[model samples]
Target: MGIRSVLSKPFAAFVVREQREWEQKAPDYQHKTLKNLVSKASNTVFGNDHGFKDIRTYDDFKKQVPVRDYEALKPYVEKMLTGQNDVLWPGKPAYFAKTSGTTSGTKYIPITKESIPNHINSARNAILNYVHETGNAKFLDGKLIFLSGSPVLDQKAGVNTGRLSGIVNHHVPGYLRTNQLPSYATNCMEDWEAKVDKIVEETIDQDMTLISGIPPWVQMYFDRIVEKRQMPVKDVFKNFSLFIYGGVNFEPYRQKLFDTIGKKVDSVETYPASEGFIAFQDKQDDPGLLLLANSGIFFEFIPADEYFNETPTRLSLDQVELNTNYALIINSNAGLWGYSIGDTVKFISKDPYKLLVTGRIKHFISAFGEHVIGEEVENAMKKTLESFPEADIVEFTVAPNVTPEKGLPRHEWYIEFSKMPADITAFKSSLDSSLQKLNSYYFDLISGNILEQLHIIPVKKNAFIDYMRSIGKLGGQNKLPRLSNDRKMAEELLKYKE
Candidate 1:
C-alpha cells in the first residue's frame, strides 16, 4: 500500500460519511440543517432579536431576519472586532480574515472556531472526491504544491488577523502536512516577489505530483520555473498530473495554463469564500459543483433582478427554479446571518443540488440598458480568443465609456496580452460580435443605433500587477473587477497607460 493509503484512511472515511449523509438525508437535509443552527444560536443577540428560538419554519425565519450586505453588517462586525464576545456567534471569533474593500477601506471578516472545519474539510474532500472518481489515489503519495498565502498571522484588537489562506494554512492537519511542499519560513514572507522567489528555490527539484492555486498566480510560478530550468513544466515535474484551482472563472486562463503545463492533467474546481464553504466539482464528468447543503450553513436565494429592488422576494431551496439567476444569501456557524455575499448563481440540478456561479450582483456593465453580466462577457472573450490560436491573454476588464467617444457611447475593454495577436482589430470585432449574439438587450441597443461597437484598449505589460500593487491589492484572493457600469475602472486604467 502507498503511504497515502496508510495515512489518509480517516479522511477517506470522512468523505464517505459526508457523501452517504448527503444522499440518504435526501430533500429534508437543508431544512433540517437550518433548523438545528437556529436552535443552537437562539440565545445570542442576533438570534434573540430575530426570534430564532420561536422559529420552526422557513417562512418564520424569512419574516424575521432581513437580508444584509457588508456595509449594513459593519456595525456588528466592528463590535465583534473590538474584543467583544457573542456579538454574532456563540463566543469570540478565533480569527478574522481581512478582505479588500473600496468604500470601507478593509473588511475584517470573522472566522469562528465552529467554522474552520467546514472550510478545511471541504477543501480536502474536493481533492478526495476527484481521487475517488478516477480511482487514482497514488497521486497523494507524491509532493503536492499548493500556492497558498502566508500562515503567520498578526493580532488585531487582541484577535488573530490575516488573509483567508493564511488563516486556513495554520490549521492544516498534521498528517496532510507531510507531503505538502515549502517550509514554514518560506510560506510566511509578506512581500509577494520575495515569497515567490523563496517558493521557487525550495520546490524546483521536489518530486511534485499535484499543483494548485488561482490560475494567474500559478502561471507566474510556472513561467519562472520554465525560465530557470530552460524546459517546459512537463520536463521539470514529470510526476505532476492534477491541478486544483479557484478564485476566478477559469475560461480566460484555461488555454494559458494548459499551454504552460505542456501536457494534459485532471483538474477540480471549488467555491470557498471567507463566509463559508459553498460547493465543489464532485464528479469528473460534471462541470457544475455539488452545493454543500449539510456543511453547517443555511442557504437562501433571491432573484438577481429583484435583489436591488425595494421589496425583493427571497426563496427557499424548494422555491428555486432551474436557469434562474439568483443572488446567494448565507447564514453559517461563523456568525453570519442572512448575509448577501453578492455572488449570483444558477441552479443546474434539483436533487443532490448543483450550480454555476453566474456573476456578482454589484459587478456588471449596464450603462446603455444592455444589462451585460460577467459570465456573458467572459464567455464572449473566451469564444473570440478561440479563433486566434496564436494569441494569449493574461488579464482584462470591461467598463462603459459613458462619455461620448467621437460620436457615440460604447463599452471599453482593457486587455493585457502575453503574446500579441496578429490582427488586433479583428480580435476586438470578434469579441464584440460574440457578445451581441449572447445578450439580446445588448444586440437590440446596437440594432436601435443607441450604442456604437465596443472599444478595445491594449494595455502595457504588468498593467494589472502594477495597478494592484499601487493599491496594495497585488495578491491573495484580491482580483481586479471584470465589468463596471461606469468609467471608474476604465478611466483610472489610463494612469498606467503611460
Candidate 2:
C-alpha cells in the first residue's frame, strides 16, 4: 500500500523505458504519432456522431476541423453535465474538474475513467522524474500539505459531478493518504465558509513539511497560520522541506515568501492544467523545466516569432531549435490534438530538452501593438519589488487603459500592498522608470504618446481575492487573471476607491 507498492519497482523501470523510447523516437515520430492519434480521437468522439469521416493527415485534419476553444465544447459538456453514462467518454465521468478559461464560463471538464490514466501517469512522471534527477525519493517522506480547493461534493440534486480535487483525492495511493489531512469528499463538500474553516483547523496543528498549490492559496494558508499562532511565520514553517507551486510565476512572490518564512526551502515549479500535467523542475539550480513528454503527451512548438502570424510553422521534438522561444502546442491523450493552450516557452538547453516557460501567447496587452508578454511584466515587477524590499506588494495586475481625450492608451498598475508606503508617488515613478528601461517596446509605446498615463492603485492585502469572491469566483480552480488581457475585470475590480 506504500508508495513503493503503488509506484512499484517495475513501474519505475517502465518510466525509464518510456523516457528512452521518447528520446530514441524518429525525428518526425511525434508529428506522425500525433496526427494519427488526433485522427483516431476525432473518429472516436466526433466523426461517428457528426458524420465526418476523412480526418487523416495534418493538412486534411486542419482543413476539415475548425479550431475550438473550451467554450465550443459546451454542447458536449452539457450532455455530460447530467452525469449520463455515455455522453462523451465510454463510461460515466467519475468527476468533473471545474476550470475557468478566458472566453469560457466555468467549465465542468469531464474527468472520465479513460482520462484518469493520463492524470495518474502525469503525476507519477513528475514524481519519478524528480527521483531520477535527484536520486532522492525520500524528499517527499514528510507531511505534505496541498492547498487544494474545497473537497466538498455537491449534495444538491443534479450537482453531484466530481471535481479535479475530488478525483485526485480519491485516486491517491492509500498508504500515502494521511489521516491527519482532511478528505475532500467530507470537508470540501461543506459550505464555502465552512470549508475554509475546516482547512484552517486541520492545518493549524499539523507539522507540515511540504506545501503545494497556487501561490495565492499558499499565501492565504500562511497568513492564517500567522494570525492563529501570533508567532512569526518562520516558526510555523521552520520544518518545511519543499514548496511546490504552479499556475503562475513564483519570481514576484519568492522574496516575500522567503522573508516571511526566514528560510530558503526548495521551490519546485510544475506545469499542471486541468487538461493535463505538462512538466516539472528537472534540476535544482537549472532554470529550465523538463517536459513529461513520455506521459500521455506528444508536444509541438510553434516558433514565438511566428506565433501571431497566420499559418505558423510547428517543430516537433527533434525539429525544435535551441534557445528560441515558442508557443506550446500539445497533443494530449485526453482528446486534445495539436491544441494551442496559448502558453509560450523557450528552450534553455536540449540535452534533456529543458525549457523555460516564458509567457502566454494569448495573455498579453497590445493596445498600442506593443505585444507585452507575461515575462516582461513579471520581470519588471520583480525588479520594481527588489528596489523596494521593505514594501509588501502581495499581488499586482497590469492593464492597458484608454483615455478618450485624444484616444490614447496607457499602462495602469493595480497593486495590493500589505503596508501603505509613505512616498506613493515616488514609488510609482520608480516603477514606471524601471519598467520603461526594462522593455524598450513598452517605453517607445509610452514615449511616442500612443499609450498615455501610467497609474498605480494600491489596495488592502486581500483585495484581489475579496474582489474575485464578490464576483462568486473566490473558490475552486479559478485564479485571479493577472495581466488582464481585455481589462474588463480589471476595470471592474479597480472601481473600489480606497
How badly does each model clash, as a count of residue pairs? Answer: 0, 8
What would you estimate as the lDDT of candidate 2? 0.67
lDDT per residue for candidate 2 within 8-61, as digits (tens), equals 445655776677676455344556665555544554454455333665555565
lDDT of the candidates, in the order given: 0.84, 0.67
| Model 1, residue 425: C-alpha shift (Å) | 2.5
TM-score of each: 0.96, 0.84
**Model 2 misplacement above 4 A:** 1-29, 32-66, 75-95, 131-139, 152-160, 184-186, 189-194, 303-315, 322-325, 404-408, 419-426, 495-497
Q: Which tens-of-lDDT digit does each residue in 1-498 have in candidate 1?
A: 587855565667578677867855544778887888898788877888788988989889888889998888898888887777777888888889887777677888888888888899899889888766677777788888878778888887788998898898887767668988878888888788677788888889997888888887888888888989998888899989889988888888899888888987899999988888899998878889788887888899999989989879988777799989999999888888889988989989876688998888989888877889998999999999889988999889999887764867888889888887899889988998999999999999888878888988888888988888887777667777888887767777887562
Task: Show model 1 residue runs off by greater than 4 Å.
Answer: 5-14, 23-26, 496-498
| CA RMSD of each candidate after superposition | 1.8, 4.0
State the weakest 10-residue window (summed lDDT) of model 2: 154-163
